[model samples]
Target chain A: MTVAAEKQPAVDRDVCIEVSNVTLRFGGVTSLADAGLSLRRGEVLAVIGPNGAGKTSLFNCLTGVYRPQEGNVLYRSRGGREVSLLDRKPHQICRLGVARTFQNIRLFAALTAFENVKIGAEIRQRTGPIGAMLGMPWVRRAERVSDEHAHDLLAFVGVQHRSNIIASALAYGEQRRLEIARALATDPEVLLLDEPAAGTNPAEKRDLESLINRINKELGVTVLLIEHDMRLVMSVAMNVVVLNFGRVIASGTPAEVQGDPAVVEAYLGTPADGGDGDAAPR
Target chain B: MTTLSAVARRARWWNHARVRRIGAYVFAGIVVALVTGPGGSEGHYSNGLRHGLLAPRVIPFIVGGLVVWAAVELGGRQLYRVRPLVTTVVSGSQRRWQSPVVRLVSYGLLLVVAIVYPMHISEFWRVVAANEIAIYVLLAIGLNVVIGFAGLLDLGYIAFFAIGAYATAYFTGRLPIHAPFTLNPFLVIPLAIGLALISGVILGFPTLRLRGDYLAIVTLGFGEIVYEFAKNQQGITTGSAGVFNIPHFSIHLLDINYDWGLPSLPYYYVSLGFIVVVMFLFSRLENSRVGRAWTAIREDEVAAAATGVATLKYKLMAFAIGASTSGLAGVLFASKVGSITPDAFTLQYSILVLVLVIFGGMGSIAGVALGAAVLTWLPELLRTHVNPQNRFIYFGMLIIIMMIFRPQGLLPSRRRAREIRFAEAGLEGADALGPTPGSGLTS
Candidate 1:
């Protein structure tokens, strides 16, 4: 159940999220079995797996969409407060500064791209419902701030030009970018993207990689993504966790995972004749 | 050969757009003439084709066709250019009236017209129509919150109206409970609203998880339960006999005191005031953060939840606010009529209000208000001309035709129009959170 064999990556920065031996089950199905991983404060970590390998389930557990029956998902805010994410609702977790994009793009389709991002920024405003209705001075100010922030995020993700167009009407790649912009609008300490480049072309995927890099390197926000594309995973992620059969089979630098016989076997179903791990017992 | 070719060319003229347009007018005129003409007169001569062409019946058809053709030529050409015309008029007015002063003046003029309307029209029935339509406008606006804003299809909205009416009766001592003191109908308004608000919560809390048709059925059942209680609650509701002698709205200020008369003017004014207030409030709610939350839930509940919106709280809030409007209308209805009956707040009333919201444009306040006024007054306007037995049939036909032509309703909100338009165009028919959001024709 432990993915600790490889030497741990250098922890020069704070750890944003710490998943401790989380296990989730639905009826008789074990969606995630004793899975654990830690996301560094400003590093891009990739969770790669084959189809039905429980990467999304693990994402759900982190986001509070699916509460793990056992173990803790902890969040460490920038202010240095460690909060248990276990009994929290999705929105509550979001408010604590964890924002995520869906595996399938879940942009508000009927809303304009600007509106979709504005809604994301809206949660950050503390104005009460009454204030919003009354258009109180502070609420008005907040709305202005929210609009500006949303526009900036859109610009950051390269979808500012499509601001007024409905999300559904956007090109597939543009919609993916808009989704990222919306997530960023939450002003999160950590951003979790579930397959951001799922349906995008190679050029768009490259843009996504650079976007993740910029979000991590420039903004210094932690980035954890679930990706299936090996090249995208290796290029963007500073650390990698490979899941096979609802468990983490490998955790290391991309090169170490590539050389790990367990990771190769999970992906290709057969070990190489000269695989280094062949010297070790299963 | 030349003569034959010329005849063929003449025959081809029927395929021309202009010729066909005129032909359509001629055909409509002939049908009207046939329908309105007196039944077959005795002593008609033989030779069917020649006699039919020469008969006196032909004159009306020919004249009708000429008149229709003239009208089309004069006006229908502009109708064909309606899209451009509307855009020009709207944009042109926008440019001309850019100042707040000009906009304010126009709004003032509209307000003056609205206030002075009943004064100029002395017809008793017309006043009654105005009063009734105003009441329905309030109801439609309330139901719009639940069905249009929150996307909760509530079919039992009239139950809140009934609750309001009964609360008015009970508070005013019209009910058999016969309190030691009777309150003014105006005084009971707040109590009635509170009662309706409570009732909304009671119904909503248990059924918030249910959606669409299931929620609709549960609300419908709630309405039926309320109706049944009002009908057979024995002495409390006075059973089917209902409460009589319900007090009218009265004001007893320091110097002046007046009791409302049975005439419809006072009631119409009050209802109009309520309608205006409700419209203002609902419109404000529609644009605010709470409104955004409601729309988010409507668009996708799971996504809304994920974004930190408490779906249950907002859903219940929608019910409370929506029900409170109906409660206000109920108090107005009980006071205006001076009587209360379970039969008055039947399932039909619920459906009628729903029809108004849907017909007008669910999320559009102006649309729903217009829908309420038009649907309520149309029958009265047509009563003299339309056959009594066929009036309902015609009404149903009109609704069906309207829905067929404009599924988004008469005055759809931009979002609703886009959703329907996209669906029709095969662009994005399925919703983003729909069961098959990822499984679509789009790659």
Candidate 2:
């Protein structure tokens, strides 16, 4: 009951996405209970927790992949207007500029790397069915633009060399990068990356860190990343939210969260002397 | 370099170059032989050792055709390399329209040939060509939906053709409904389409979950079941004896009838008109959102669905639409023939439709039309002068040779060729290395 009351925060004007008092129940099990979070524009927020911390479920709820029965998910659009993402279809939500990547890749395997990126640009196509039928000049122009933009995005992610290759044929790291590029191609104001460093080698992870930093600093794009790698979350994120058993244990800058007693208990499961905190950098 | 090492290095270089050169030369030699051989002069060869082993007339055509085919292919390759961008753009954009235009022009050419040629041909040849073109155009359009748009391999599409024919027969033949029960042939068209749609849904529902070869097998079974039912059902279908005097289409107001006695030319024009309309509709559908969804589903079903495409619904729509086209063709056939028999719709018809779709280009509407025209004309050309036993052998050989040489069909769609290239690129480098050193095959 204490956990339930502590989770729901009153809505604020700056909050772009507000998940309030959400509870996800599947039969007899509750995956997330009274879980709440708020995302804002031009902020890189990191959500860190162990396996069943309900991070992905929270992401699913925010993106309209699943509609939580108990609470509301309000997304503020690019026009400084707010709408409930739960009321819209996944594709409609995507059109409203919320894009995400999967922890396990879900690319179009049979399509070329370029085509996979192009599908993300489907919502941006200006041509109607009639234009495509007639091969109208306007449609052709739009197609050229889309292809150029797709190529540029792939290059930004350093996978442009594999543009014509089928997506399934790419190396694992390249595929991961391609997925991110695809998400970016949707031209979303906010990007959600799930485990960007999960299977990446050290060299690739370093590159991913720089990429995330560039996306935040130069592009001014809001990034909400759920990463299990603590070093990545601590180093790159401006703010960190720690979760345990679907409830936020602590929320602050990396330094403040590092000192929280509850955060320690959540990570180690039981509290001991805090000396070993340096053993694994907070 | 030492003599032995230098010799070994030369041998390695020779092996690589030799294989390629041999392939090229062999290809060229076949072409040259076909062009210069007796076919050019219309000479005949007689072999007393075995009477059935050779046919004088056939040998010339086959050899000459091969030579012409090879020279064109070699020329095309050289042209492609010399002006890559021009060829790519021309081939890409023009390929889509080539089939329909080619078909229109070829029909005109045939008309000219018919008039100018010194020798007089039989009336049956004209009938055969007209019927073949009409039926094939319909079949190609039907198949264009399943294979071209939806990318579903349907090996037994002829079942719908049989369904259409049977529906026409049952309605106009012996159905004891009302007083004397004679449905207008025009009315039977819609009825046939409706029946085919119903059958399409029935067939599609169970096999919706199936993909690739499994789906093909289930469809083949469905066709066989339909065939067997027609064969055994004597009370309704009249069994193997079939129904007779089904009645041809007539317009009393226009004063047209079997006795009004229009020549086959009028029927040919009508068929041509229908083919044009179908081509227009197919072209529109191919470039629409529905077509893109079909291509997306074909490319990746899971990704398509994830992008908010209703994959199952679109696929079923494809099947139903395709079956309806076949049904429409069947109605025409039944009305033209004035009778219906199960023999008219067989596995061979299904394969023939598939061959037409493939020979044109799977996803290209114009290619399908061209394919229909060529295949239709080829048989007629053979039957006019060649032996019946050898006609099929020639046809089979032609298909085999085409598959080996030009798997993409005569006028391969640019989009489909790109897809094939992408697939080949993925497989080529890995397969050529010939399994790892420790692999079972190498060991």
Candidate 3:
């Protein structure tokens, strides 16, 4: 399997994560079947599908939230290190520079906004439990850095005013932004955002489009998004991958996938019409 | 017409929710008094009721009603409306007491009082303070790390305590199976802690994955297993006879030599010292990075893991810390008593210690310590009034009432207070992480 994939010459070291022939099934139901995609370095790739095309499941497979029974997820870090994410726990994958946010907002609701971000930032720091307990000078220094970074990220996401407020008390848009800030705090080289603009207003959606661009361009991080907003995807994503019934039916530039007959038919009524993908945002 | 209107207005007062709650409290107080009250002269409630019309009973009821009403009303956020002067004085004193210099002076005075307290107390009281109150305080503080900090329920914690005591006995050559070399009780502290830590890791590695009630039931079974093993294993644990003649702790360093003998005062001092040390360490750990990690895990495990917090490792760490503390307390117990028995390490002690943690305030250091002291000593104080075996009946009543009235415990941590207060106000409750698999209303 490795020789065949290597012989193709497409699985290069620059691919941040490669999902090939990865299949996930729940009992008798198949959430994903032989689905595959590659996230290249420092690129914005959007995964689009109807309600049950297994977009989130593919994200889960990449982020180590779920294991694929059929194939493996290969993660290659920025410094030329290779790791198979199949056997790793969520935290271990996170430590390996893979960070993600949930489709449903999953911040620590009881913690302060600053605390939520700081918890994320501190995960990558090298401090053992004993060091934390002893409050060694280096640990304090590392903690101070994390605190400052949390403050910075909060401001970066434009929610610094809600620093001390508990996360549950924040507004809907603010919570979404705070979750982004938290995901960014992991210092991730690759970020997986699951439906970040799901319930936001038009103005908040505009803010989210720019935020994704900044996260991809300013931070030099590879972005893999599962978004339903076709306007945001066409405007921000470099390429789009469309899934239908747990299969990647279309993969190309935004304009190309937008005109694919399979994409239009899978989204609209039938394969006979040439309806633009922008009309199927729901 | 004016008199009739006034009568109607007066009748409407009981409809208020707060008033109805106070009425419920009064009824509960009355029921407790009636059921737990002393037997009548003829061993019948009617016999006692026929004469006085409950004169003293009526008086006690009125007093109790007034107290509950005051507690309910004053416990509200708007205390100034009732008495501005009282509220001002309370807030002013709290602010003053929390200032750095004032807190330092208060702590110094407190330490002095603690030191001077047992020295002058009666021998019987001193023994009770050390044997019953102080020991349980140590155990409660240990369990606080598990239940309070980690939000994991452990009903089999006493198993670790038993392990510690057995390690102490084995090290001192008191058990039927002797050690390779007899060691002083002081020397056995570290070994016992290591043993308890390893035991906790063994138990928690597989079972910690089970959340809330399931984890609690597993810990409960672990405790029963240890208890049965101690009871039935004659060759190893001396088979219900228990290990006897465990030596007292002593230190012989350089020219200075001190021995913990049969006097209970030294034991109280030592226990107090350990309690102080553990409190300091745990409090320091509360706001640190590790502490935040624990809070994150407790709040939402899946989110915590996604954010790179190792949930399993930190959870296992909490179990180990809690178990090691229980072990240390066990070593102290064996040394202080100079005898060990399976009777001392029962499921009842685990429940009683949990009660202390909840009664005091789950995560607050001073609160749990105060809870342990009060609950344990109160029963002893009532030794002449009530049979010792019936003490749990009162505790059950106290816990049930407390759960209804003040589920956050007596003095909650600031974060917990905020969460519970928000939850009570119908905010930050079911809607936040309501359907998440890692977080639920486990309690």
Please report the candidate that would top TM-score against the real structure. Answer: 3
**DockQ for the candidates, in order:** 0.33, 0.16, 0.49
The residue-by-residue lDDT of candidate 2 on A1-282, one tens digit each, is 243245346325566777788887767767678887777677888998777988888887776666777888888876888888876655666777888887877666655788777767655565654466566787778777868888988998999999989777799899899988888878888888889898999899999999999888877778999998888888899778777787877777777777776777677766354455533324
Per-model TM-score (chain A alone)? 0.92, 0.91, 0.92
Task: Give the per-residue lDDT digits (tens) of candidate 1, residues A1-282.
Answer: 233433345442377899988888889999888898888888899998788999998888887778889989888899989899988877888889888888777776677899888888888667765676566899889888988998899999998888999989999999988888888888888989999989899999999889999998888889999998888888999889988878988887887787777877777676546544543211
lDDT of 2 by residue, B1-443 (tens): 59999788768854665344545655554544432333211133333212322434344445555555556565667766778788878878667645878757775785566344313445575466456677778878888889877888887799898888788877775532222566877778888989998899889987866766777889888888888888777866777787677666656655554431234544555556667667767777675555766776676554454444555677887888889888888877776666677787778888889989988888887778888888888876876455544466567878888878877777776556655665566732121112211121100
RMSD of each: 6.4, 9.2, 5.0
CA lDDT scores, all candidates in order:
0.80, 0.72, 0.84
Q: How do the candidates rank by lDDT, highest first?
A: 3, 1, 2
lDDT of 1 at B95: 81
Task: List the candidate 2 regions with Cα displacement exceeding 4 Å.
Answer: A1-7, A11-276, A279-282, B1-122, B174-181, B254-263, B384-387, B427-443
| Model 1 alpha-carbon drift over 4 Å, by segment | A1-14, A26-28, A68-71, A271-282, B1-107, B178-181, B427-443
Interface RMSD of 3: 4.1
Q: Quick one: ranking by TM-score, best first? A: 3, 1, 2
True contacts kept of 1: 0.38
Writing each residue's lDDT as its tens digit, candidate 3 over B1-443 gives 99999778768978666777776777766665565555344345474344333546645765686687777686665554668888889889888977989977877887798889888889999989888888899999899888877778899999999999999999999888979998999999999999999999999999887776788889999999999999889999997898888898898999979999899998899889988888878877877887888777777778888999988899999999999999999999998888888988789989889989988887777778888888888887766665555566666777798879988788777566666776777753222112235354111
